[model samples]
Target: MNLKNTMLKITTVVAVVISFIACEDDFATVGSSVIGEPGFNASLYDDAMISAHSYDLPAVQTNNLPLNLLGVYRDEVFGTQEASILSNLLLTSENPSFGTEPVVDSVVLAIPYFSREVLEDDEVVYALDSIYGSSPFKLSVYESNYFLNTFDPETNFEQAQRYYSNLEPQIMSNINPDVLYETESFEPSAEERTEYIVDGSGVTDTVTMAPALRLKLNNNFFQNKILDKAGTASLLNQSNFKNYFRGLYLKADEVSNGGTMMLLNLLHSDAGITIYYKTKVVDATDLDDDDDFEELIEVRRSYTLKFGGVRVNTFEQEVPQFEGENLFLKGGEGSMAVIELFSGPDANNDGISDELEFLRDNDWLINEANLEFFVNRDYTTGTNLNEAERLYLYDLNNNSILADYILENVGQPNSTSSAANRLHLQPLTRDENGNGVKYRIRVTNHIDELLNRDSTNVKLGLVVTQNVNLISTYRVLPSANPEVQRVPGGALLTPEGTVLYGPNAEDEDKRLKLKIYYTEPKN
Candidate 1:
């Protein structure tokens, strides 16, 4: 029998069997009887040689991120991390006019937090999401003279400008001496805010909005910088306006005892600086009675400057030292673990491990391969840190997701549900008490390629991720590994971390390992 044709037929049969089992939601129960062939039998072999090492990540690119983290957080194991934001303001309209005698009433800056509405006692209330810690932190906003460019001049303006998370020091140097807004003890609130409006009939109406980080800015600064520059060359267009008023730097500082961190959606429609002021308008109270009777009256008006154009998130973290016993995975300029499968002595020096060569020589039909990582319960049992709900694995050499990840995520919606891609990248398993147990990740296709298709066995990078569906990679400045120039973008969006037992752990039962189930001819 031709070996190439025989293997092709076997691979096709395995694909059909796997698809059938996946439909039944019993993918892990592949047994010998499933093949339904008397000449073949299925078996399990899990003594694969594996090596894993943890490494600290350098400051990553944080500009133009989908979500921004603000405030401070101190992890018992990873030390303290403070997040801040630097964003350029955009004009609401070109050549905006505030009418006659535009006097500033109040300039308010509002950025909504990630929250969900819940009905309690027949009244609607909100519960915040993605907010870590409960302590207050100092928040300050300053006028920045630094220009955030759209493209990098070093790249001949062809590439988008990249900003690192550790660029806060350089940003601070360009900020104006006078602060725009400051709060010594600022905490995120879940209470709704009521905005009262007075119409022409002198009737007051109230409108309630969702929970947000709302602060009153310095009105005097807006009065001179904005209201006074109406119809001038500075306010002619967005380009001129951005240059005149660079932007604002929102900084977070640690408190005495503890600190809080919140993930904010700064690009929300309602997130911006609203300037409420009294402007001169024609009085229409008696205009109907006499057409010539024109009286200039002060009327309430407001205009907003949106938070847009080259927004960047800055992260300051304390890098944790890695020991070989356990692996640490954190997001946002944190650490990640490198994994090598079938990594043992290669006496032939053919670049292939001896253990992998033996498996290939057996001609065993690969059915399933998985990596199980048990969480280190000792460090996380009673801690306040919010552990990541998911972890992402990718090919470090190619800077892409593994073949198994792509196959499993097919036709699956982008969601945070643990059951979405359960067959491939299983979510963090939690016990009855909400403690993480272990994560079982399927690398069946990846293993098949290495064992049967003569593919290179590349190193895998694992990191805590906010969502598994986000496979886009972001460049990391000063990358620790030359092969690891980028990391998953979802990892940067997460503020959680986890510790897992590595292969070198003293507890052999929970040590990370690769288990492969195969089928072979009954010779």
Candidate 2:
């Protein structure tokens, strides 16, 4: 028989079997004349059939978002990932006031680092979180003469702008015509620095601050761009300033062996450019003295320009293994894994779709459901190759989020208490022997809806947890509180991947699993 006809026949047989079983149970109900009395306590429903399969997800758009760049780096398992950033500089003030006789001291660019702290015993130890392969590559900064057009004149619809992952740098002739600033290979530091804080009584106490990247820019470059035209009309407003000074393009030069990559948070409060100078001031202390009558003294002055405006992170991925197999779960937007639950092949082909249908035919109360993914330890256990700390699971077909993710308030406030966080799965953990490190994603509500409600069963997508909220923002409506705009959002641009065991892998013990815990009614 055809597949549809066979399914109908199996469903008919399941209905008949259920009716017969009900009849038998009804016959056994002898002493239930008094209504509202419980029939029997409960019985365990042990046997539950679960189906799982995985496929290679198509490449997704990885650009025109808030994702920061991960500079040049090459991994043995994940191949190469090189990233660059193009952004506009924002003015700190409308009309910058640099006094006459100002002397340029220095120009500096600062980008903050991302770090986390762990409790060693009683004290907390800080470490870099999203950084990998910390060797170091030559870093360069160039003035980007290529202007990012804010609006498209043709459509005039605010221009739903987007830049792709595979796009190359369209360098302009005004790119300084020379490298503005170049630095030798440098590694990011996790060490802390001491900062002295003075109280109202002038008593000082030292505290540690996080590490950051502060590059000293060329003084001559900024002297001409910023200081020379202090009183000009172009320097009177931010719009005129941006139009005159274009932007910057930060490029990390190529490196042969294992080059390093660092993830920077340009939007951090500490990340920006500062121009230091000294303006002429009269020595008023000795003005009354004939020895120092109105002597010119250098008084320090500084103006800051923050990193903002049309910041776009471009990503390029070269994962050849992704073309040949489906064994790993890559986190970047360019590549990710497709997950299918209850929608794989048939029982004859080693899939569990048919098995799930069989269980659905039988009326069983699903107590809890979970999906666990085991990492391919053979490929992910090197000194440099570490596993991602958190992973996010979402519905792939919807291009939105799973309803359970919202109902459970996965990333919202106060959703992290013991009872509240039950919906959010625990972090990556391993067995006692430390052999199989796995991640478990809770899908009890998803399974319950699939089995009980009229919800659509679509494939799911998995990625690093940070990618979920990378481009998410609140949109205000007429009556409701701000709603989230989630679709077409960006994913992780940082180059990171984890090899997870698929359902069809060779090892049965380490294969992906969909486990369901249930209970059956007793009479």
Model 1 Cα displacement at 111 (Å)?
1.4
RMSD from true fold, candidate 2: 9.1
**lDDT per model vs. reference:** 0.82, 0.59
Candidate 1 lDDT over 111-171, as tens digits, reads: 9888899999999899999888888899999999989999999999998999989889899
The 10-residue segment with the lowest total lDDT in model 1: 3-12
Clashing pairs in 2: none
Where model 1 places Cα greater than 4 Å from the true spot, the runs are 1-36, 196-205, 283-293, 409-419, 479-483
Clashes of each: 0, 0
Model 1: how far is 427 from its true place, Å? 1.6
User: What's the residue-level lDDT of 408 in candidate 2?
Assistant: 46
- lDDT: which candidate is best? 1
